[model samples]
Target: MRSLIRQGADVNAGDVGGFTPLHDAAREGHTEIVKLLLDAGADPNAVATEAGDQTPLLDAIGSGSIETVKVLLARGADVRGNDDAGWLPIHEAASRGTPEMVVALLEAGADVNARDAGNETPLHHAVARGTSQAGSVQIVRLLLDAGAELNAVDYQNRTPLHAAVATIDPSAELMRLLLQAGANPEAVDRHGHTVQDLARMNDNKMAPAMLTRALATARRDTGRSR
Candidate 1:
């Protein structure tokens, strides 16, 4: 690769799809190659046209390449850079449930509540893409601890709790966690669907009951606080 650069190869040359050498290296998790490309003067923040205008940092996070992410960050990549889809590296990290990556991005100044084009935060992606209820619960706890807004609404006006209840197999524990983190069970979506409405629509038997109990508890807590 160094030989090619010395031979007058354009380090920033893009394919027909606009993916530069850095995008390839970063997407494939080639940490060393990424360094070489950066040293060759590859644009660290170059957006790939075929890949939804995603920066190399977004690609590295999508591929779960933490080492490559570090390399990009060290070379002055944009930590807050988003793809054409409006996904930040932190959103990808949270969606993948990689706590270490989440911590790394957070330390590098990734916004915990940075909304995507759809107005969804990393917490929203974390819950929506969670492979298991337990894993989703853990990610939620991590984001909440990092000051994620429990009541952040998406484009549809759905909170994380709304997303949780709409899951194929909604966990009462997940719902409880959001409520405890100050999510409003009474919040409605664009179609005028509340968390309980989503629970019923998704046929999540446990969620409606749980949401009801949570709402009652929240009301009681408010009353007591007053």
Candidate 2:
């Protein structure tokens, strides 16, 4: 490592997969080694062309180490680096359902509302999680707080609310959270389905009650303004 750097090892040299030393270290969560390579003139933004232009920062994220992710950001790893799927690191973090990882990327100015190849935002990814992870709800809240477009539709014209409603065993907490954030209950998807429509279609027994309550609240609020 240090000896090789001192001996003029090619820090940025890529293997057949275009993976540099920085990519390897970051992927393995070897935080110190990442720093050492970066200091030795490793290109933090070097792309693994054979691997969908995957950067070291992307690997750091896949490694699931906030420390390694932070080190990459500190060394000038571009948060906006494009991968094969048109996903930013934020998209990956959001789907992985780690609130802290999303927070780190958000703090580094990752686009909370940025669309991926599927035209889905980080919010879409968070809500589309079929099975809830530990911080899934918090991830949704974080994106909302960061100004994620709650109603932003994807290629399927499905908003985050739409996606949440269609999830198998959708969380009541998530349903309430989105409605509280002012998500439109009547918003339609590509198939012209509303939240209730999707709920019924999916046999989601939970979302209907919450959606009804939200609609009633919206009516009450509307009446007051009148």
CA lDDT of each prediction against the hidden true structure? 0.81, 0.85
List the candidates' TM-scores in order. 0.85, 0.86
Give the clashing residue pairs of candidate 2, or none: none
> Which number leads on TM-score?
2
Pull out the clashing pairs in model 1: none
Could you give candidate 2's per-residue lDDT for residues 59-173 as a string of tens digits? 8888878899998898898989979999889998888737888988898989888998999999888887744577888888899999999889899899888888787757656
Best by lDDT: 2
All candidates: CA RMSD in angstroms? 3.1, 3.0
Candidate 1's residue-wise lDDT over 35-131, tens digit each? 9999889999998877688788888876777788888998988878888878888888888636767887888898999989999999888877634
lDDT of 2 at 172: 59
